[model samples]
Target chain A: MSAKKLLVGIFDDDHTLIHAIEHIRHDGYKVGEVFTPFPVHGLEHALGLRPTKLHTAGFMFGATGTTFALSFITWVSTLSYPNNFGGKPFFSLPSWIPITFEMTVLFAAWGMTLSFYYLCKLYPGKQPKIVDPRTTDHLFSMTFDLDGKDEAYIEKLSSLLKAQGAIEVYIKEL
Target chain B: MSHFESPLREPLITGNKTWKKITDDIVVNTTGDIKPLWLIATLISAAVAAFGVFCIGWEVCYGIGTWGANKTVGWAWDITNFVWWIGIGHAGTLISAILLLFRQKWRTGVNRAAEAMTIFAVVCAGLFPVFHMGRVWDAFFIFPLPNTRGPLWQNFNSPLLWDVFAISTYFSVSLLFWYTGLVPDFGTIRDQAKPGSIRWKIYNVLSFGWVGEAKHWERWESLSLILAGLSTPLVLSVHTIVSFDFATSIVPGWHTTILPPYFVAGAIFSGFAMVLTLMLVARKVMNLEDYITIAHVESMNKILLLTGSMVGTAYLTELFVAWYSGSMYEQYAFANRALGPLAWSYWTMMFCNLIFPQFFWSKKLRRSIAFTFFTSIVVNIGMWFERFVIIVTSLYRDYLPSSWIDYRPTWVEVGIYVGTGGIFMTLFLLFSRFFPVVAIAEVKSILKISGDQARAEQWDEVKDDDVYKTLEK
Candidate 1:
């Protein structure tokens, strides 16, 4: 979303791409984004991205499920259509544990996954704008915004990427 | 960053695997021409499934009487199959969730297919309870829906109701977890497909437009960890709740405190067996030996041995408890199971589940694919009999002497059971053909760490000081 004109560099390996990112950033050039086929360990730290808060969101969703299940079961057993089964108490908490735990898992899993998809803009029909198709296969790619830069700056960055072991370098409007 | 793996540990992915090679090996199964063997297997399974469908339809049209459920032996093959299938499903979640929590790297090879098996098994498991309702049309009565007739709610205390919630939730969460894992792999396939082609279009949609950005992968990893955490207990609780269906009852054999843990162990035992049965065939048929190597098979066999021993211990414990309680009724139930008319099934369960898996204690047998496959099937048969022996033996002879009656499954009942087997195979064959049976991306992630060639290289470059420095960093 930053710019249509991008300087894209593709690396054949994740380790090289990670080192390239650190070197590029160390040299005072802002790396736009790196795309990979799989999750490369330590790549996020190399990119200076914040740790994901998905787990926090999962906790909240699980809590929501617990509250809903408990309150719903209690209300059903007590106020609404209460029935004495084998002379047991109206609101039996021990008996409610299984369903409550199930609801907690159900809501947490579904809620966290849906929220993840939302945050990542992943949906059934979304046509992804990929920098390089190989990024999802065997390649790791990094893009740099070239909209405001002059040709000299682009040349310097391209050479730097090549020196840092970029297998391919190109300019593309995406 | 370099990965540090012990040189002594067996590589998870054998062969000199690179990312492209891994993709080609797995993706070709989906994108390339279908093998004649797969097509034939699919056709046979489909035909069986069709006959099963016809039997179920016939039962639905006529009545529950089409099955062999009389006054005494009320729940025979139906509940047995349900519990058996549900138990079989446990292996998938265990491999995906529990192994993941423990950081077991070998799971990557079999997790995808195992998870798929879980979904299919649950689907097969669900059919029994729904159709067992007899009037299948009134299946909704199980749900605690707000009703107009006195707003009658399902009894909250009933384990049956808990079962309803547990099974449905288990199915849904497993589906979510499986689909979530599949997304990135779909992206791998989509990226390889020819642009604007139908294969590309389909995979593109299935992938949910995964671009594999670092941030997205970060979230993906986080989500996977949390889901694994949630599913760990969820999987355990599902079988526990299922056991509660019988454990909560007042019947002699069914009413026992050991049922939950015993059932869970047996479930995992049978589930791993099923996984072995499927994966051994899949690896051979799909030519995925490099991914699903003997090490994977041996590891799974180890699990079967452990869970099998646990189940054996449970069987012995149940008998001991029955004898120690000094309750004649409980003693009678255990005695009836072993020496009664249905003792054949009970002994079959003991031999298959308890005695057969003991063979896995031998390393030579455990590592042998052929032997492992044989024992896996035996274990599943044993588990089915275990369920059958518990459900029928306990129910057939009630407290009243007049209620004692032998039960036999009608042709329809046998047909449905066979049909579910057909259905499971059909779905699995289709999944194997269409989807990446192995998780491509996850395998790739571990390639640098656990791949045979990658590890060899890492062993040379990795040093004690380097590992410590990396740790510090």
Candidate 2:
């Protein structure tokens, strides 16, 4: 990937950040990514991001767990080596419910979380690409790729950001 | 930028709190210097934990004979502590998962610490059964993995094996949920720490390189919601399986179908009490009264009242069923519990688990920190006795008068029990000192909508009529 020039705008409040993203997008300048100290309501919609499908992944994983648990337990109790337990049936479904349910939840939670980490490129000791450190503290930030934009265009975007209540605006190479 | 909240709803966060203030107040507990009081407490807890460990070592080396269990009472204090500790763990998941799904905003104040309590409680709980196996080295025999000895498989129909799966699943899932929530808060601390310092590096790795990007937060929120959905039922099932351990047995008192719901309610009751016991001391010691306010205390006390009532009702129902069923053995079991040699323990469980929590019915007592703290401890003790009453009383005097005998825990057993307490405290203290005790990011998210200053300042911005007008449109 080629290094790119980026325009970054930092705001002190979540509301201001949301408003800035709206105005920036309305002006037809492509918004790259925005970061905040905490999840800001309505900010994703303002950035035109789609809702995540992580829950679908969770469902699939849970289904896999259920199937695996039922089959394994059934195989172990019946085909592999069946013993007369309380003179009950070989495949006792009620007794197997608890383990199956637990396996379902276990798979769904861990699988979804690991998938999330994979999608987000998040892992222990991985260095984050931080535009502004304050974005994780008290500030909200919006970044725009200006890879092929002229100085005049950059100036116009910076002025728009200021007008939209940006606390600070600057340029950086990423 | 603005959202609707009923004016009558009390602020979840008290005092004027900004994002910066929230970060400083919570993060300082971890990033700043450790307090002398915390050090002293840790030392004491560590010492207790060490003694507990030595007791375990003695039991392992000398065999399970070191315990007080005999022919009549195969399970006494060890199993009692196991059920008690596991029950205490329920509150954390309940607060984190169930309350989150219900949109009870008050949970944000206590969820993080409560979830940590869940993890530590499970750890302490897991020790009993493992050590009770006598040959701790052969504990792997519990698992159904293929082995050299005849390839003997565990009985899938057994409740004990179900407990192995249930508890292990509960522990791992709770850990994931807790650590997932911690990632953003760790990011906040990582940003606050001096760059390239040890604190910074440690927090950075712990945070898993979270940068709080909008897309990442969106995904984070999704993951949390799904985890909460999974944990709600998982938490309930854990206790249900625990109850199955007894209910599936043919013992008169143990064979009742009411065991599942009774155990779950009792677990939640005990769990909430433990959370209150810890949070009350923690908020005071950490000077976090603003975040974990009286409203939070009252909310928790209300739950204690509800679950306490459920437990009380279960106790009464058990007695009624015992008599109403007209089964002589069952009737005899209930009679023996109430009027037999171990009647004191039975009454203690009733008073502590049932009667003491009823004081919360009074609004004043419910909100009083001193009363809540005292009742919290009382409820915990009561819960321990509930298990004791259920296990020992039922076992010691079963159908056979020839084998009837009294059960008592030897010093080694008691030491191990006390040792688990030490271990729990040690883990909790270390957590509070080194980790953000409160979910800082979550607190910040709710600050605008439910904070005292935010509400007071925005009081005139949107009228209730205007909100209604918008709704009408």
Candidate 1 docks with a DockQ of 0.85
> Which parts of model 2 are misplaced by more than 4 Å?
A1-3, B458-473
Indicate the worst ten consecutive residues by lDDT in candidate 2 chain B: B460-469
The list of candidate 1 runs beyond 4 A from truth reads: A1-3, B458-473
lDDT of candidate 1 over A1-174, digit per residue (tens): 554998999999888888999999999999998899998888999999999988989999999999999999999999988997899899799999999999998889999999999999999999789789988889999999898899999999999999999999999998
Clashes by residue pair, model 2: none
Q: State in Å the error of residue B315, model 1.
A: 0.4
lDDT of 2 by residue, B381-400 (tens): 99999999999999998578
